[model samples]
Target: MRSANPARHVSLPFPRAPRYGPEDQAAVRDLLHAGRLSDTSRGPAIAALEDAFADLTNTVYALSFASGTASLHGALRGVGAHPDAGVVTSPLTWISAILVAFHAGSFPVFADVEPGGVNLNPATIATAGQASAVLVTHTFGIPARMDALTAVTGVPIVEDCSHAHGARYASRPVGSWGAAGCFSLMERKPVSGGEGGVLTTNSRTVYERALTLGHHPHRLAAELTDPALRPLTSTGLGYKTRMPTVAAAIASVQLRRLADRMAASETNFARLLDVLHAHAAPITTPLVAAGSTRGWYGTPLIITEPVPNPAALFAACTAAGVPVRPLYEDWLSSPLLQDPALLHEAFPHVRHTGWRPPDPHALPNYQVARRQTLLLKVPDVPAADYMHQVGDTLATVLTQAIR
Candidate 1:
């Protein structure tokens, strides 16, 4: 029987957002005092945030959007994805990544992920047939093999950097590898603004197109070369997905503290890994490719062998007050992705040609890994005592489950 009070067993919540400090409070206060609560035009705060983020990612331009989905919508459109165009991507990612392609009038084709990793295998990309573009996700803060992926597929790549804010590949940042990188500043992200997103790009055309897709009509008009076309900007072609000034203000403050947060997370993650390895548990720690610096999204513990009853392990962990879950359990089998009726209602235009649901049998690696992976939430900066307790708890739970 499950305990009536789970709180008595667990010390902390499974996942908790970083607490805001005086800096965040001061930013909000300043925004309120200015009397400009909401402005369509890229206000001072928004512009400053874009500039700061662009500099951080080493990109020529950065555009803020209402949400990560909105940013991805603009990015897909900006990269020239059209109806019937095949966008090859990993099936192990969030549903939003696949949905963004459908929203952009592009069909998503599944690419198998690396055997033991959470990222798309570059080799499997070609199997998706003729791909117009590729959407690569640095899943769970581990950087994908961008250099290899780009070398193999000459098509444009849009990186989803939502989970990998401070991650790096081969000494370069994750966002810098793709044609345009999209990031989320949602509540759970490392550096959040409550709800906001940013897209970074080095290409002027991609930047202009993304701006036209999300920026206000007036902002779009100013960037237009032809004076006659400026008036047409008022037509409701744009998504009206510009990030609010208040959110931008909060994001700016968060961005400044990203380095410290990343450093702390890395240290804590290393300690946990050490503990897990020392115990010789039948689990695989997250694999970091050579020359890559992975930021911690969550601690992924891959079970070495399939348990007789996986639910029992989860139940035990929950009862013990340790929150754990599958990293992503067969996302391809989700009703949202497979239900033609639901998909048709959501994207009516794509029903005819662009909507092709992925075959679950096609991606063997994704199928195998999805079931074996379990996620553990680690604080950005955990105390030594807390981590030791967590590590000990995890080891004990696994041992009991196997026995």
Candidate 2:
């Protein structure tokens, strides 16, 4: 039997983001007043942040970039991806993933994701055959089966850590597992700045190439260098993708408090997941596998039972103040999918592939993705009781729809 909304007129929003502390504001102001807004003055802070981040993840090198897509471009360039050596990534990801591969002169071969909404399925990728590298995103903070993926395919792995910063699988950090790990410090990410990204790896050669692609000029940071990179300083050609010092400063402060923020969000995510799971007959709430510590980007809920109208479901969530919507509804139908002119600048490989398989995992690919799944934003961080109200409210609303 489906339960109804017992509480009348009570509104609940998920979690809200944590506010930046005075120290962060002061740091940003100092950079502003000093007139060293670019990478020159803030380079040191960004370097420090990179070092701190590397240490946190137990990796050897970390590089800061303008955005996650920029980092992706650098990662691909660093690993030597060519036009023929296509990049294999998940179709159920942000278009930025495919765009990055295109920007780096590689074709993006979209694969299907795993059942639990984690990483791209390795089997599907293996069946596709002969790709230069596999770019795996730890979707929704859940770590992909990195070990299984890497073990099966001997190709290099570039991990998209945009949503999984500080997340771990089997006690090993996500970034450390890949050849090059990329993270987003965008406004909505766990480590929010106005905009920025970071890349990490242990290989000196890969690090050198990434630095060159990211516009470091090779000699910018003496303290952070591999002896082998000394000669490349003169010949280095740089792209203007370095993160601004101001954004770097903000990310630095956020990095310091990341552990606490992750803990708080995890608590909220767990409680909400439990409540949703109790009423899982209608909605398949986000699942975290054993030995995985997730960095909840957005709490995803899959509607198992078909809804009469996805548009109506979205309206109901919005009407209830839940602010829920379908995940990337138009990703496949947008300009990139239809009108190639709209995405020509960002993605040159927009030519249609016709009826080729999108995912190797045998996962179903629907024409209108809007009807398949629903995604709800997890308040950047919400009050404890308010979090409960959100779960209760969603359970109530969904219960009504199912009935």
Candidate 3:
């Protein structure tokens, strides 16, 4: 039923973690010796990371958080999300993107992504009715149609730049196009610190609000300009989502090395795509919109033909040492939104309002994409020999499976 190739093997490991060099080790060692690991003690590492990130993204403010989810929640609160407001966002994203709305006491309205594209369609967003805010995700490092989306919607826009830290659309960085942009530094991300996140924004109000929500009460008061508001510092209105000093140190080093890593990833992606095209492989790669530069998180491939037994293909790929898997394979349904019991427990306000769950079947594009697409993990910098082997393995397995 299935073909297996035991001889062919990919030398590179799957999900390779970032290696710490002398600079990373020195930063951590310095932090440990200082015994001031907390940001409250004016930790130089965290402050330095914030400043570096702000400068890199060309944003006025960059606030670090414990995780990308925390940063998203903070960004939502910073943009004035209320219980009565609805946030229009793409459903084809990480569950955390949707959960942040619930954490902020805001309702999430699903918007369908464009055909053959991972980002939300501007037309779909426009027809989603009145929304207080719109969240755009540059899914898989491909820049969304920010210009058109912004022009169509008259509301606060937040860019989910977790997979698109260095990606650009029309020569402008993703984080600069919206009211605020959120990034992740988790282990799997292109640039990671093991675990951390950052929110960048040009708006001072948004920055101040996010800082107030993420930082400690005493620290928030010290940074506040309004004398009257300073009194409220005894009990800050926000949660504790501050980043650790050590993680910041790691992230700073990774940020500095992002350009080179991206270049290598881009080159490898081009090489693989070329191999696939040259051999007339039956897998389609993700399309990059004009003037948009992808960060190349992972190469997305769409099966061009229907396989009689999909599991056989997967088995073959796995046996051949190819890190091939279903796209968004972990999620079956949109959480909370799809589960009424969980939604009621998490957000009690929804029970009284009588909410209706979005029909997954209605999202034709998302459904088709999910079913047809597979993700291939490529190393940041792959060896030429490794690339050749990968190309041969993919072409062989896919061709066999299709027949």
Candidate 4:
């Protein structure tokens, strides 16, 4: 049985959407009235959005898609991994990170994550030795060690920036460091547009290939003529996964305010970390790499306890009204991956190339991750003193629960 209490709310209860305003509403209305919502090479609005994204990420080209998973699949195809070729990635990410490879007709080889809790370590990747390409996820907006990864794999690298929007490594933007970088604009990400995604790259060839692989017919206005790609574009079928005009508009508005939003979120996160530390929460907040500026999608903490029952702690927090949620809570227990019909239709090779959870007790990183975590939503435009209540609620709830 769950306790019912209003004074101890789990999180702030503001009704307004963050980072959205009159401008975003107006942009949506404009696209809605246009009635031509699909993305096309000639759509001026879409082109403008793409150009804006490219500039923001400091990349030569940016392509819009319906979701981050689509962007990842397109990137895999752009790098030319065949159906049977194994591509390496971390299992600790959202299942989509692995599913994207299977969708591209490639096998997703799992790698172990580091103590930092981002993606797999570069040294581990180097030793895997079977992967044809590496797809690294910046889990929870923490940048993976790109320098070490690039040095070890020496293969085309794709960065899953789904959790990292404004993150950087050694003064370089996350997307700028990889062969291709992908971002998500889902409801909970740094830039929320309901649902949308973008893929960026400096390589003209990779951009053109990803565009074709994503199944978008090039409009004359997009200026994407590559003699080498015409035939491939003609024969390939796309996933019909371009971002809707309205989603793009919403994303564009959020993108404009991303920097300020990130700054506030960082401040909120640091304050919360301090509170947790003061309470002796028995958890380690994520370590931001030197020379890296973090854009936290979710603030991750590691519980060093050998067998921390996060479910029990989460229940206790909820009973006290902290509005806490897990980052990827008990994902292995979900049935979607096991559903025969769904798996067969969406991932035919799942039995052979499917995802499997590591033995939690045996995995050093998983053991570290088993500690309780809470994700507090940082509104796009936060109230001046909201962090005070958030930090206080968390400290109170955690102090009572961390036995």
Error of 4 at 389 (Å): 3.6
Off by over 4 Å in 2: 1-5, 8-18, 40-42, 116-118, 218-235, 277-281, 337-372, 380-382
* Model 1, span 287-387: residue lDDT tens: 77788887666656778867666778778776776657556656678887788888788878766675567689888888776666777777775456556
Model 3 residue 47 distance off true place after TM-score fit, in angstroms: 1.6
**C-alpha TM-scores of all predictions:** 0.92, 0.86, 0.91, 0.86
Please report the TM-score between candidate 1 and the true structure. 0.92
Candidate 1: C-alpha lDDT: 0.79
Best-performing candidate as measured by lDDT: 1
lDDT of 3 by residue, 75-152 (tens): 887888766667888877888887687777777777888877678888898777567789888988888888899999
The candidate with the higher lDDT, 1 or 3, is: 1
Angstrom error of the Cα, residue 373, model 3: value is 1.2
lDDT of 2 by residue, 1-403 (tens): 2235433223644445446779789989998888888763235777777887798678898888899888888888877776666788876677788768777776677666665454587778876556888899887677888888889767788989888888988788988888989899898787866798888999777777777665755444543366755665654556678888887888888888778778887777667667666656466644566787877676566677767777777777777766565566445445554555655545555343222323233445432233646676665453677656666777777777655
Q: Write the per-residue lDDT of candidate 4 for residues 90-177, one digit (tens) a residue.
A: 7668888877877888766766778646567776776554666789998877788888888888778999999888889877899888
Better of 2 and 3 by TM-score: 3
Question: Once model 4 is optimally superposed onto the true structure by TM-score, how far is the C-alpha of residue 353 displaced, in angstroms?
Answer: 7.3
